[model samples]
Target: MVSSPSATPASALSAHAITAHMGPCAILHDIHLALAPGRWTSIVGPNGAGKSTLLRVLAGLQSCTGSVQLLGRALADWPRRERARTLSWLGQNESAADDLTVYDVAMLGRLPHQAWLAPPSSADHAAVEQALRATQAWDWRTRALGQLSGGERQRVLLARALAVQAQVLLMDEPLANLDPPHQADWLLLVRELVARGHTVVSVLHEVSFALQADDVAVLAAGRLRHHGSTQDAASHRALEQVFDQRIAITQAAGMWLALPRLERPAAPAPSAAAPVSA
Candidate 1:
């Protein structure tokens, strides 16, 4: 189900013959993919399958052997500041200074839009407020990042990414430390982004959540196994095969869920008859 570049000239993002190496080990093989505009795509795979690596390459934050196009133009050709303005990235467990206020942390996303040594504009403040509210972290705007719980920190970081207001967002393990309700909130946020014609690419370990994306990209051993609509049979087969069929994809409550295919624990052996008689 690999998407052909020829079919999508105006893709939001496209990679061709991408290969990445970490030291002497090749982490990602040749991968060709094109992600549609105004859509959400989730990358899912087993550990060490290069999901994060692929995302880094897409963000132009990692060195790879192939070319990536952003908005139909060569990624490498874009100026650094311009590229930063066009793409926002949220990495797993991203760290910020503990003493920085939540609002200050989110303001970091506005750097690309500001001139050298210039102060944040009114628009910058507005964007940060909107982003913080979107993540439900506005009430803690004045609080230090260190004072918050892990989930709270995650939401603030998400706010920072959103404040960039980029055309495309690349998030890796964005759901880390989030509770179920917050995770559901993230789902709704992504939908809102897509509806506005923004492109979102996320690496999600939660397969059920991944299925909620418009498309799924399943990888294995650093190779692209499949990239297609979430409802496509081929995509489902690839998912099942990649995880060794230890999970079953089923429909429940009008949404897809990837349930584990494990047998119930065997009942404990009955106590000795002598103990019962006593």
Candidate 2:
């Protein structure tokens, strides 16, 4: 059973009776969710659980039967450029021109704020530099995207998203190619964003990292199993059950950890060979 939303400031984003379909296959059922402002919420689930699909719907990048609202306004009512400026999206394996320099790629994020066919303004340049620095990609600003490693490319993409300076960020697998240290850096960056009153919604496969968010939204088979504070016992139970009870959540070193609950194999069926009296 899903718990109600914990006490929070006005919601930054919300969806009501959200149902989505791809061809004849239903990707998401009637779902309702609200994300709080100035906080981080992680969406987690098994494979094919519609985590990414739901994110796309919230970003206004996908079509669905239900209503999605951004800051008390219907998403559909926002102008295209206004919507782009208000909500930023960083998709998994996002494609960009291989020839573009790191700085140029990140500058694309400023498009919504720039006048048509106009050169980037001082504000745009500053935003790009800040974003690159935040992602630790500033040193590689002069390099082409094709010249970077997968991890480096991912950082550049993240910088691009950060450059948008949007109030709400929707990230799908933002840690895809990040190593442990870089993943830790990403966590710090998210904390900073939340501290600054931005809303962050991420779909993360890393269960341990997901637990670090202010809230966890568990999905299973295109349905919302639970949505509650990470510290809530009900949230932990839903998380374990969604993974078939194959994991256990434990606290250690002042943080939560999702450890595997490995099952011991059934003692190999008494050797089928006829045992001779030795």
Top model by lDDT, which number? 1
TM-score of 1: 0.91
Q: Per-residue alpha-carbon lDDT of model 2 for 1-278, expressed as tens digits?
A: 01123544378899999999999999999999999887899999999999999999999988999999988789999999988888999999998999999999999999999999999999999999999999999999999999999999999999999998998999999999999999999999999998887899999999999999999999999999999999999999999999988899999999898999889535666758886897
TM-score of structure candidate 2: 0.92
Give per-residue CA lDDT, model 1, range 85-151, as digits (tens).
8899999889999999999999999999999999999999999999999999999999999999999
Show the lowest summed lDDT stretch of 10 residues, model 2. 1-10
Candidate 2: where is the Cα deviation over 4 Å? 1-9, 264-278
TM-score of each: 0.91, 0.92
* Clash count of each predicted structure: 0, 0
Off by over 4 Å in 1: 1-9, 264-278
lDDT of 1 at 67: 98
